[model samples]
Target: MQISDLPYTDPGVPDARSGPRFLWWLGRNQAGGQLKSLAWGLLHFGGVMALPYGVGFAVQAVVDRSGGRLAFAGLLLVLAGVCLAFGDTMLHRTAVTNWITAAARVQQLLARRTAHLGSALTRRVAAGEVVAVSTGDVEKIGWFVEAVSRFTAAAVTVAAVCVALLIHQPDLGLVVALGVPLVALGVLPLLPRATRLADVQREKAGKATELASDTVAGLRVLRGIGGEELFLDRYRRASQDVRHAAVRSARMWSAISALQVLLPGALLIVVVWHGLGLVRDGRIEVGELVTVYSAVMLLTYPLRHFEEIAMAYSFSRPSAKRAARVLSLERTTTGGPDAGPVADPAGGADDPRTPPSGDLFDPVTGLLAPEGRLTAVVCGDPDEAGRLAERLGGHAALDEGDVPGPSVRLGEAPLDALPLDAARAVVLVQDKDPVLLSGTLSELLDVPASGNVTVDDALTAAECGDVLDALAQASVDEDPMAAPITERGRSLSGGQRQRLALARSLVTDPEVLVLDEPTSAVDSHTEARIADGLRTVRKGRTTVVCTSSPLLLDRAERVVFVHEGEVAAVGVHRVLVRTDPRYRAVVTRETEEEQRRSGSTANSTDAASPNGSGPVIEIEETA
Candidate 1:
């Protein structure tokens, strides 16, 4: 099956049955292969039992003094050795296949779920948890799945050996068989405690992984603030906690292992002692006594597997439950009839397919970026604006009962109705500090869909011409377009990274490009060039710039001022600056004290100088 076809819809309120159901689903998906593996396991385990029987016969024959049959017993012993070797080889081969296939299935499921959830997945789950699930948890799940058939065969084989021994010497066989089970049962009470400890270890490990990821992602900023050592200290503490938990978990398993070895050894001793008595009393023939003793000894192999299977299960069960939890995350619903097959948009603009809706209306803030216009969203509180943006992009669900306005709609279509790919294609929401992936300048600018827009043209529009020149001046052999950017564009200045990200978004040429403070990082000259360039590039298409930048606002056809996350004012940038007190207080930030207010920064004078006729406004501070 294609990776895209994996089920991503949550099955709802997972219980004990969830893990088994998922495994059963996997089994059904690979029914033929699983059956073949199971058959091989059974054959191998059966062969394992046959060897001990053959050895017993050989021993009995030596004791019987049957001179002519002595060579026959020797030949049987040789054949038994061959069977044991063959059984071991086949068992390992089948088990490995089961492991690899099970891991592949889980990987496919995770990939599908990640795509289905998109950005929401990170918001809902820790980044490290996702990484751990894909890596460590997947392997543990495979271990349990592959262990299932071998465990079953081993159990059955052990039972059969016990029965055979009972037939040969009822009293001794019964004691050995009964005592082995009692010792195995002793582990059950400790199982819950062991699993709990294992869970704690896994949780701490996940947290440590998350801290490491966070530290790496923010390494540049941490260094800039001289806080690298602080974060490093915190990460070390987290790692130690994980180590402590791991040691605790290992102690439990060590105890379990001790029991596993001790119980089987004791059982062997009991069987040997009782069998010697029977032989001395002449209650059984030497050959029969040998057979009984061999059977009991053979049982040891399967008994060891029993312990191994138990331990494998205890470790894997928690991992499977974690994977199941990830799989259970519901795909965000867009509450409309599925968009049926449409002609590929790649065919041409005139193809029967209509461009998807691009309007974004938010009920909470009563904000609307009407179709086909340059709109500005001015939020006094940047955090509130961020929440609105998430909801607008359909990355989050709104509590409609608590809000009292129309939902965000793309054209006439609800944002959720459009498939994730189609929605993303139509409306690109650029963050205030959009991440620049590690790549060459050309590659960074070449986002998913640029249509006929060339990389050079996108860079010029975002006013990154100078940035490219700087890269070239550094005597770098790499083409500016080919230069390798560090993660999050740490290699470049903040303003340069912001512009590059803008150029990338501009290249995509989506129907509605929602940019959050696109020029917040750039200086006046570049900001002016970007404002003018955006207007020229986005002429007829709908573009929403969520910023308090007066230069960008001046270029916008409509400026919306948001106060306490509500549309407190809306008008031309010039008109709002002159008339609206809330708008004036936010945009002008005229006083020195106002600039120092929490979360507010000195507004840049870039736009006023460009047009040469507007009042000055301060820029917003970035997190």
Candidate 2:
């Protein structure tokens, strides 16, 4: 596969039985590239091996004083030089292509797997591990794959050189031939130890990477809580552990390198010593001695590949294993025995049978959401609220055996029973902390534009007009919506980022919108505006918003109070606030927090505007 043919529409299914098996799978996928690499490798190594014979024949011609033989020897030398130059150049080109193509294929597979698993991928694998596998691990795997053909060609060339040596001088050739295997296999005893060190180093490195990733992602939170030093120290220790492991791993490989050099030196000495004896006994001519000696020296170069292949395998084995583990993750949700494929929802939300626009039921929490109504779910335990929201979207957490439990049904059909795309289309779950990708504002809010909602409509409903104004202020020349956003919208305030994410989800206009605290980051006034806009935009559609804010709850048509992971009460927000003490306490606490924030804001505004010309928004309980 070439780089031009990359980003495959469908990266084929991978073999995930084991690391070696996965490597073999990659090789199989790029069989043509591998063959080209192999052919180039043969040409390169063949030319290298011919150098010794060219020198030997040239020496023989000089001794015989035959001009014809000398000319033939010169031609042979010229031919070897041409092969060397051409073969080496092409070998490098093909080798790099093989590496790039292999790495690209693995990266594509990873990206495909990541898309298939969606949010579950991060939940199952560490963010750093995924990053590591896609970047560093992929390159390592490709290196081993690209190295294999060269190693094979080297072995073949070495064997052929030994055969030629034996034909020229049996005594010295036998000594050199026996030493060749010894040099190649001498490192076998140390391989297991080396592999163990490499594994340990990789494991520690992954942990360090994970720690660093988490630290960076949560740096803002850490600073807010004055825990930056604590996390910094933790990362420091993790990085140190990685360093120590790498050093230990290096030591073992260093020993292997020492043996590589030492054993070859010993073998060279033995070959020379034996060849001299053969020359003294007149069993081998001086020219034969020189040829055998040259062949042995040339063989050393190919013998180094044995050690290189071993090291590459040791490092790549673990990397491929990690990649395979990630690739092995399957879509747990499948249709039931009696279930059939759900029809595509692309046409419109006209079909009542499509779950997203249908009534929603969460059997786990015993919460029922009526179709075409705005429902609010409030739970004292934020964890329970989060879990319930996920379950409501049919995200059944995998059990110990990696199997999904019962699924929530939409429109009388289990959501898990629907095709993954169909299920996602029907129910869109917006997490409490939604991610805002780095792109222009347009790209950030670009979803499958449902004809029901336009970009401007969704952004206005999300109460993000001020956000656009702020972005416009930052860049006067460019359109605010066309301006670039930093990763995760870090450049924007928390409230601004949150509203943008909501706008993206709003544009989709799924049948059932499951939002976990959509307006939590915004102020009371903004939240009220958002709540009213959301209610208006989502009229006659199933909307489940997990929130406790009085402003948002008061706007909901129905409110479900969940306690201890079960629905405790179901009524309008006013009725629940008056009757349920637990519900009242949660809302009351949030009200107190909002009041304190408003007072702080008012004090700051008073100081900044001594003339009191600027307007100040006050917090209030809309309910």
Candidate 3:
């Protein structure tokens, strides 16, 4: 089956049984390949048993010296060698093929599940755990799956060899046959303990991986705040813990290995001792005794597989559990009756083409962002506004049981009811500091849209004309319009990065553009130009700017003041700033003194210096 056909339906809440079920489901999907691999394994291992029996016949013929049969015995020995050589080669080939196919299937299923989960995956599972599952867990699962057929074939071969020995010489055969199984089964009691140790080792490794990922992602901020050493120390501690867990797991595996070796050696010794006695008593022919010895020696090959199967299970079980946890995460489902196709506010749903509604409303916050208008949200705390923007964009889950205040309706249809692709098509949330991936300027602005907004137009709209001039003056080989932007635009100044991100967002020309503090980094001159340019460029499209910037606020048609996360006042920016204390407090930095005192003393001292340089600088004046 194609990767696209794999089921991504949420299996509901995961339990202990989920891991095994996931493996069983994978096996069922690839049953045809699995069966073929099994058949090949049996053919290969069956060949292994025949070689030893032929060797015994050759030895018996040599001992008898009867009627030129010695020549036939030599032929039997040569045939036995050929069968073994061919069987070993074919076994390796089939097993490797099975391993690769199983790994590919699991990888595809994971990719499909990840796409379905989207952002919800980060919320449910640590980023490190996801990485581990995709790479290491997939390998472990493939190892276990591929081992299954070989394990079965090995068991069968062992039984067949034992039966062959019993028919040739019952006295020695019984002891050899019985002892091999006892040696192989002896490892079973240690498996549970070994598995537990392995689980602990895996958990510790996952935690260390998480700590490292977090440290790397935040390394810049950590260094800026002089917390790099602190985080480094913590990571080192986590690494040490992982090492300890790994050592413990290794110790358990070592004990199991020792037992596997000891039991097999003892069984071999017993078979040899008993067979020699039977040879001396004249109760068994020399050729028959040779056959019994050959069968006993062949038993070791299958017995080794038993130990390997145990090892595979010990590693794979936890990996499967991790994969199942990721697969079980459920995406938020809008429970309302299907509202049918969404109508465009500008035209009818039956129309072939129309711009979808740009309205965004939050039931929890009672915030209404109307369609085809410029709106500004002024929040007392910038962090709160940023979080609210994520909720409004449907990137996060809202608290249940709260009144469904104002569903973000596209005409009569709720935004929540729309598919992710459809919703993204209508509303785009551009962060104050949106990430700019490494690419040429042209590539960065390459968004999904019909019209071509020249690089000059986007730059003008974001007031990035100066940034273009700077790049030109630098004499960079790349064109200003085609200049490469580094990852997160780190090469550019804060203002340049902010404008470039805004330019990129504008290039999309989304129906509803929700930007958080888009102009906070730019100078007043650039901010004013951006505000004015935005008004003209997005005149007919809906735009929501979450900023306390007076320059941006003046350009907005309506400004909503958010107090304690709820809308306290809504009107023209100047009107609310004049009448409302909450609006005045937010836009005018009324709490600057209180905020300074609460900040770190060292940073406060730097801010109060006569030179006007500080680690914790405030941009409240811009607002």
Every model's TM-score: 0.83, 0.86, 0.79
Q: For candidate 2, lDDT tens digit of each residue in 546-581?
A: 998999999998888776666766777776665445
Measured with C-alpha atoms, the lDDT of residue 383 in candidate 2 is 71
| Lowest lDDT 10-residue stretch of candidate 2 | 612-621
Off by over 4 Å in 1: 1-24, 338-352, 357-359, 380-383, 395-407, 432-435, 450-452, 473-478, 486-490, 523-525, 548-551, 562-566, 574-623
Among the numbered candidates, top lDDT falls to 2
Quote the positional error of residue 110 for candidate 1 in Å: 1.9
Candidate 1: give the clashing pairs.
Answer: 334-416, 442-481, 602-619, 603-618, 603-619
- In model 3, the runs with Cα more than 4 Å from the true position are 1-17, 66-77, 113-120, 166-169, 335-337, 342-355, 377-391, 394-408, 431-435, 463-476, 485-498, 516-536, 545-556, 559-623
Worst 10 residues of 3 by lDDT: 613-622
Q: What is the per-residue lDDT of model 1 for residues 1-623, given as tens digits with 9 covering 90 to 100?
A: 22243332432222323666665565565555556556666666666667666666766677776766777767766766676677678778777777777777787778877777655567567789899989998888778777877777777777777787677668777886797687667677777888899889988898899999899877877998999999999999999999999999899988987887777778778877887888899887767666666666666677777767777777777777777767777544545445343323354567656655556677667677777888898888887776666667754532212332344676566665556676677677776657777766666766687575667778889998888887766537846766677777877888888888888888888878888788988898789889999988888788888888888888888887777666766678887775555576667666656535632233434333333223433333224
Clash count, candidate 3: 0
Error of 2 at 263 (Å): 1.1
Better TM-score candidate (2, 3): 2
What's the residue-level lDDT of 145 in candidate 2? 90
Q: What stretches of model 2 exceed 4 Å from their correct place?
A: 348-357, 379-384, 394-401, 454-457, 477-479, 548-551, 561-569, 572-623
